[model samples]
Target: MASEKSVRIKDIADRLGLSMMSVSVALRGMPGVSEKTRKAVKACAAKLGYRPDPALSALADYRRRVRPTMSFAQLAFVTDYPVKDDPFWGYTNEFLYGAQKRGQEYGYNVVPFWLREGGMTRKQASSVLFNRGIKGLLIAPLPVEDGHLDDLTWKYFAAVAIGPSMASPQLDHAVFDHHHATQTVLRQLHERGYRRIGFLILRRRSTRVHHMPLDAYLGHQYRHEEDRRIEPYLPEALTAEGFWRWFDDQKPDVIVTDAPQDIPRLLAQRGLKSPLDVGLVCVSGQANELEGVSAIIQDLKAIGAAAMDRLHTNLLRHAYGPPQHAHGSHIRGHWQEGMTLKK
Candidate 1:
């Protein structure tokens, strides 16, 4: 039954038989408070359910002869996809949850802004953020065809890219090593005595032109002298019919893809059971379980959380410029062994 009105520092101080200033320093973990006294005050404060009003604390500090401290107003999570329909919402939700938890601990709030709403141009987005006094940004992976953000100025705020390295010279990014991930999957398939491996991917200008996984798949296929097949589906196509036709024709013994559901359904339609006539491995498994599909699970949630951590570090150090290629911190893909692969 403790409402916000009853959870003040004075209530705690009165109960603990301590001065407000002593209790304040102890609660804030500032110096000048003895260890024993601090512990006692903290225990009493917890017992009374005392919580400091952040707004009032900021105001009080400003009114005193103290130098103004930069309070975290808002950190913007910008994405090009529509909020409701984007397939990557699950990943985004995890990222936001991680960010919110960390932001609360550091005294900040995260604000999400979708690019699909109202046709947000870079200039318009920048103007809106500037007006709202938001100086931090975390950009999720945008379509590669959208190209680099040319309209937004990087000098005004700190920013970080949350996925693959876009061709932007004015941003810091944290991205998974797509080549490494593909190599891992291919190597696993190779070790399992599966020689004829094929890759299916959506053919997009962005993917064909810039995606590294496609290049890696092609390179690996050529190097091993394995019978390689590629079924390039239309970028906008997601029907089972097109996938079934391709599956019937290629008839690869083992295949790797991003969509697990489509692969299983296609196989089922063709009267081919997985791990019997064909093998399956999903490159980026987004679903709850692999079901029958073996997958190279890239922990995207961890990637997003790490990106925020890097962004916060850069902001604190005031380092803003082109994306520096970070060494030593590699994005490792975890292999989930499933029943889809043949022994």
Candidate 2:
């Protein structure tokens, strides 16, 4: 049996009739070697029981930290939203910022690529990414009508989707725990003496995420009396007229919605007030920033950082393509108190 010390990169190189430099580059996932050559080199190394030297890896990591130019790893944040009026602008910005910040810490540059603006088909985009040496992807939550990216070359890179929107490739995902977030908010509201808490969201948004929040709400309702449970107010789109109609019909003591904007305004139109006549809470992003609103604030920045962490872990383990087991991570959002909910 060949011992670890007996197997080396040069030994594998000589057996494969390749240069030591080529073998070294292949093992490190550098650009010098073709993908086929890299695969061959890795196979040979595995057959020979080759293991990397921990000290050397540590040294390389230190050098990469001290001198970023020494490393060439690049990742991408793929999205369809444009720079202006981005659908996910406020909600997903933290994810972008966190991914970029953490990626840099690991000597990997994470850049954003707008799929719509590029005017390229999925195949064309893949070619561009391949030529640019982008070996990792952080897919953002997509619009309801378009989410799947099946044409992209999955085998060539590691990928982690931000949410359930990118469902086709079924890549590993990092997402806010919508179920837990809803349960938490309901629990808090109940504790605060709110019985009839109404849940509201755009129908498309809820359906896009497989109605995880709605599921939680439905599940929680069973725990309370029938009158205490309010059916969710799902509208096809936002309109003051539609919302007012629902509000009037439900007559809820509190409202829980993804969009907290205009809740006060809508309440004012009915000669009502938040926490005085009706209470309000948000199960969305930017909750802490909402004045007078208690919320289950989704920490998008933390979710982004977590996604990068998962990507890096896969890179280190030589895991690529759609994950065999398709691991997913759900980060629970925190409860933030403002003046929206009564004390």
TM-score for each predicted model, relative to the true structure: 0.66, 0.83
Per-residue lDDT over 141-205 for candidate 2, one digit per residue giving the tens place of the 0 to 100 score: 87654477888888878889997788687888898899998989888998998888898888988
- For candidate 2, what's the RMSD? 3.5
State how far residue 91 of model 2 sits from its true place (Å): 4.8
The list of candidate 2 runs beyond 4 A from truth reads 3-37, 49-70, 82-91, 238-241, 287-289
Question: What overall lDDT goes with each candidate model?
Answer: 0.68, 0.83
> Superposing all C-alpha atoms, what RMSD in Å does each candidate have to the true structure?
12.6, 3.5
Steric clash pairs (candidate 2): 292-340
Cα deviation of 313 in candidate 1 (Å)? Answer: 2.1
Specify the poorest-scoring 10-residue window by lDDT in model 1.
Answer: 61-70
